[model samples]
Target: MSKLLEINNLCVDYVSPNGIARAVNNVSISIAEGETLGIAGESGCGKSTLAFAISRLHKAPALISEGEILYKGQDVLKMNDKALREFRWNEVSVVFQSAMNSLNPVITIGEQLTDVMLAHKKVTPKQAYEKAAELLQTVGIHPDRLSAFPHQLSGGMRQRVVIAVALALEPKLIIMDEPTTALDVVVEREILNELYDLKAKFGFSILFISHDLSLMGEIADRIGVMYAGNMIELGEAKTVFSEPQHPYTQGLISSFPTIHGPKERLYGIPGNPVNLLQIPQGCNFQARCSHCFEPCTEHEPVLKTIAPEHHVSCHLV
Candidate 1:
């Protein structure tokens, strides 16, 4: 498969009167064309920050301190305003976390969806309207609902509308930051089923970011485990789930219940998430890790390929 998005040594920081909080630290990841790569981590682990940085959507005070965000070999970090505007939505779109609630309450769904196309000058008003209806139907929503305001629709319907908006331009890559986090299990499953269908039909790649490891295993071809802003493990979803190398990954897998297997205790990871502002030296997982070695606390470990297409960051590994 061809590479679609490549992030190298990506560092994102939030600067304010308080201090500089390193949200994403030297994180490197890539996604292939038409592939789905899922990033699983707890809250405040830089999952959302990474998504924002990818689209160059991070506002002032929160900035990309260092990194190379390359989309199809283009430097995303270096793009100017006009170029960045053109790059976003047209090539890459984002379905933000709680995107269902992000819909504008004042506008009808049709207007919101059409506005995106109009902003990009991708279509005329008439054409935008026509495409809006089609996009709604594509996501299993009724075309007539396009005229309805966000408040008039169910949460699932609103979520679908948000997805339709992201699919408006048939973007090559869609950064879905917990796209279904707010929905119930049934609704989430339904939405994911629709998402899978849409991806197959549209032939676009997806970067699915969520805290749910089991859900990621259901959707993503590859999984990258993040801890305290660092990607501690990266590998095929099945490999990462069944044979996790990093201690953090192991604890994460153990925390989630498996339906197919026999019942087991939910062994949650101990210790609160490390504060990004005062990130400890060496392995971030060392403090929480059960298999902490002397080297784990003394020096940081670089991500290294341990097996074919499997990478891990830990002194033990």
Candidate 2:
């Protein structure tokens, strides 16, 4: 697979009156054509910040302090305004956590979908509307509901509509930030299955962001675990789940219940996640790690290759 996107040593910071908070610190990752890469971490771990930075959508106090986001060998950060406008939606689309917030409440679903097409593509009103209806149907919604407002639909339906809008321009890459977090388990499953089918049909890569490691194991070709704004472990989905190298990755896996395993009490990682505003010295997870040692407290570990396409950042490794 050819590399579709490459993010190298990307650092994102939130500059405020008080101080700067490092949200994404020297994170590097890549997505290949038609592949799905899952980023698993707790909230405030900078998963969403990385996604926003890739699309150049970070605003206000959020600043890209360092690194390069290369999409098809083109630097996204250096793109001119006209190029940036064309890059979004046409090349990459984002499905945010909340579908309600992503959509316009007053606009009909059909209109919203058509609006995206109209804004980016050269199409007639009739053609755009027809495409909108087709997109709704493609996502398992009835075309009739295209005329309904966002509030008129169920949570799952609204999410599907959001996905339909993301697929409006047939983007090469889709960044889904907890796209199914708001739906029930059953609805979430259905949506994920449909999303897999859509990806297969469209041949587009996906950067799936979620706190659910189990869900990531199901759909991701590879997984990267983040903690306190740093990537601690990255490997194939199966390897990461079966043989997690970092203590944080192991803790995250043990916290979830498994269907095949014997019944056991779920264990949560001890200690709270590190504060981004004032991160402690050495390993960010050393405070919570039972395996912490003198080196873990004194020296931060860089990512070391454990195997081809597998890496872990830990002194123990």
Candidate 3:
């Protein structure tokens, strides 16, 4: 497979009155063309930070401290303002968390979709309207609803609209930052099913971020597990689900329940996520890991390939 996006030792920091928080620490990963890569971790594990950094959308106190973000061999971290404006949406688009609520309540859905196409100069006003209606239909929404306000649409419909807008310019890559966080399981499943269908139809790659392991396993071609801003495991979804090498990955796998397997008690990983402001030395997950050893407390581990296309960061591994 060809590489679409490559992140190398990416680091992001948040500055505050108290101190600087290392939100993303030397994280490296990639998504192949026409592939789906899922990032899974707890709330404060920097998954969202990484997503924002990839799109060059980190703002305010958040700053990119180090590393390279390359999209299709072009350096993303060094793009000029004009270039970035052209790069975004045309090359890559983002479906933010709770994107359903991001719609302008006062604007008509058609206007919002048309605005994106117009902003990118991808189509004329008349063509934009035609494309907008077509996009709504593509997401399973009635074309007539383009004239409706956001408040008039249901949550699921609004989410589909957000996705429609992201697809208006036909970006090659879509970064979905927990796109279904606000929807119910049934609705989430429906959205994902449609998303998969759309991906097949458009051939765009996806970078899906979420805290749900089971969901990631269901949709992602590969899965990367993050903890305290560090990527602890990277492998095929099935391999990681069945034979996690990192202790943290194993603990995370144990926390989620399986659908067809025998019912078992949920076993949560002990200890909270490490504080980014004062991260411990050596392994970031050492405090919570059951297989921690002397080396785990003294030396940080680098990712090493354990099996074919499977990598792990841990002394024990």
Best by TM-score: 2
What are the Cα lDDT values of the candidates? 0.92, 0.93, 0.92
lDDT of 3 by residue, 1-317 (tens): 99999999998999999999998888999999999999999989999899999999999799999999999889999999988987896999999998899999899999999998998875779999999999999999999998999999989999999999999999999999999989898988998999999999999999999999989999999999999888989999999998998888888888999888899999999889888888788888888888888998899999999988999999997
For 181-269, candidate 1 gives per-residue lDDT tens digits of 99999999999999999999999999999999999999999999998888999999999988999988999999999868899989998
Q: What's the best-to-worst order under lDDT? A: 2, 3, 1
Query: Number of backbone collisions per candidate, in order?
Result: 0, 0, 0
TM-score per prediction, in order, is 0.97, 0.98, 0.98
Q: Where does candidate 3 stray beyond 4 Å?
A: none
Q: What is the per-residue lDDT of model 2 for residues 221-290, given as tens digits with 9 covering 90 to 100?
A: 9999999899999999999999999999999998998867799899999889987877778888998999
Name the lDDT of candidate 1: 0.92
> How many clashes show up in model 1?
0
| Error in Å for residue 73 of model 1 | 0.7
